[model samples]
Target: MTDGDLDATDPRTLPGFFDALADGKLLGGVCTDCGQVLLPPRPACYACGSRAVDVEPQSREGTVFSYTEVHTPPPAFAADAPYTVAVVELADGGRLLGRVAADYSDVAIGDSVELTVHEPTAAEREVALDYETDWPVHIFEPR
Candidate 1:
């Protein structure tokens, strides 16, 4: 779909991105102008301020760029506290932040990982807004 035709149902939008994720596909926005990759496809390129972005399939493989453990989470996620979260640099050049299946002590910079998607848990859905209840959760698994 063209940028001008973007809507909540468009892949460039969060809902659409998760919809594709639910089906096991990873989509990214490639900047036609500067080759920048946007992780959850957007209508415009953040690096070049260009609207010439195209949605395309992206590789699930990536390496840990950075990470941390959350010892204190919001009430909704208190049961899941002390989880590892990380910034992974994908094979296609897009960097995405997501939960890591490994523990903080097990993950390190440059560790290989692969993106994995799953339906949101009941607890997650409980905290999500109506429009986000159906969005899938993405995690990075050690590869």
Candidate 2:
């Protein structure tokens, strides 16, 4: 689905998540019941299944937990074919999935990475912008 605009105030949804991303911040939901941090920022905590949660900013620094190459992406993202997706473990203790912009050969487990926002090309913006700022996608790069 295409998300043209994001709401920065509501971190429990994708709109808020992307809103935070555009503002140069990564966000997570903290479980009030079990104290577990949700990287994707869900309304309910996955561990304890509690709705009592708090939204907070996440550290931009993270270690590469895992990675894989996407040789054939869906049509909407075919322009970014052969890109790499990596699971980064945030310094505060949670995992986040993000697209890696660097070469696949340059990425490795345990590599250091930092959150970065990427703007789509003019063609991409004209076709289908994912969010505000003419389609800004969240990504990570080797730091």
Best candidate (score: lDDT): 1
Backbone clash pairs for candidate 2 read: none
Deviation in Å, model 1, residue 142 alpha carbon: 0.6
lDDT of 2 by residue, 6-106 (tens): 35557778767776776787888888889899987877788987877788888888999999999988886788789999999989888888898788999
Any residue pairs clashing in model 1, and if so which?
Answer: none
Question: Which stretches of candidate 2 lie above 4 Å from their native place?
Answer: 1-8, 123-135
Candidate 2 scores a C-alpha RMSD against the true structure in Å of 5.2
- Residue 143 error for model 2, in Å? 1.1
Worst 10 residues of 2 by lDDT: 1-10
Best by TM-score: 1
